[model samples]
Target: MTTREWAGDAETRQVTEVASERELRELIGEPNDRAANKIRSRLHDLDRQWLARSPFCYLATADAEGRCDVSPKGDPAGFTLVLDDATLAIPDRPGNKRLDGFRNILANPQVGLNYVLPGRSDTLRINGRGRILRDAPFFDDMVVKGNRPRLALLVEIDEVFYHCSKAFLRSQLWQPESWQPDAVPSRARIAKGIEAPDIPLEQLEAHYGAGYADRLYG
Candidate 1:
């Protein structure tokens, strides 16, 4: 990603940052009734409808020490299993073996999820506790493209709400013209540069090439 310089002069920056809640609230006042009162302890009918159509979400988790990680999870629409009004199960898709977010969940059950749909400006936010399940009766329900997840993350809802579209509007995330997927470096080149200098560039490129998508379920 290209980094841009701050548009303001350095001299105009504030000398002291607003560190306290009082000072922070003074800058951005309290939320309105609609915003503050919209949180629900469990999923509503509409929330269920939303999850049924959402193909992607961001999973946020933190370890016991508060070190955080946010990972993107996606599948065909209705991939999330709504076990009950307060319970949800997300299949563990194949990906890098790092398991950063999963490791965080093992140490700290608390988690946050932001569900998004393509072209939608608003988002669904869920805060809950999570645990990993090696297998469940519902695993059959999570099958996709002839592959069933070996594990899944179960979340017990604590709070659920709809977030405003201010951030989405500001960033124009749904706009294709705003996208710069190659603004940084290609995945293969990046891996060869930082993670595997000894690996041949051709080999890395081929590993991340056209056949990459075929391995999504592998």
Candidate 2:
């Protein structure tokens, strides 16, 4: 079916867009003092402390043409290296390695990060300029499970702040009762359905089953 048919008649639909900063500000109002003044150009002691406990983060990058990607990075707590108040480094690990975000960093240095700690509603956010390093003097310090990262993304901070937890609260993210893993297909089934239609479902299931965890760091 055509898009107009799928979305119903466009002329009869209420489609409103906030087109400019003036309209957006008029709708949401200006930020109060605390929210407006909270942006920082360097990481504070509190930010460092938060990084020490955060095991996961989402790396946001966009290429010169403005295509974007958000890649998830995780390790044991404190995986990120805080080189100084303005500089930070994230070690790379093995994966399918499409290198979408890394390629974006090559084309555009601007990057953003959202750090998360398990069971925590609030998040730490950073906006910075990023560069990829094949090797660094501190790489030895980033060793994990007998594996030393061969690459790391270094970021020079431009802004840092703690994000509020309202989204998490509204979604009940931390409440176990809100989880419904079975609401969607399993990983194997999903791979077969969307990515590998020709592959046998049983093979995909086995690939994602008992031995899957063993290949995480391999």
Worst 10 residues of 1 by lDDT: 1-10
Question: How close is each model in CA RMSD to the real structure?
Answer: 5.0, 3.5
Give candidate 1 regions above 4 Å deviation: 1-15
Q: Summarize candidate 2's per-residue lDDT along 146-210 as a digit string, tens digits.
A: 88987999999999999999999999998999999899999999999999999999999999999
lDDT of each structure?
Answer: 0.93, 0.93
As a whole number from 0 to 100, the lDDT of residue 112 in candidate 1 is: 99
Regions more than 4 Å wrong, model 2: 1-14
Q: For residues 1-218, could you state the per-residue lDDT of candidate 1 as single tens digits?
A: 12334336544433454567887788899998898899999999999999999999999999999999999999999899999999999999888789999999999999999999889999999999999999999999999988899889999999999998999999999999999999999999999999999999999999999999898898
TM-score of the candidate numbered 1?
A: 0.90
Give each model's clash number.
0, 0
Q: 70, model 1: CA deviation in Å?
A: 0.4
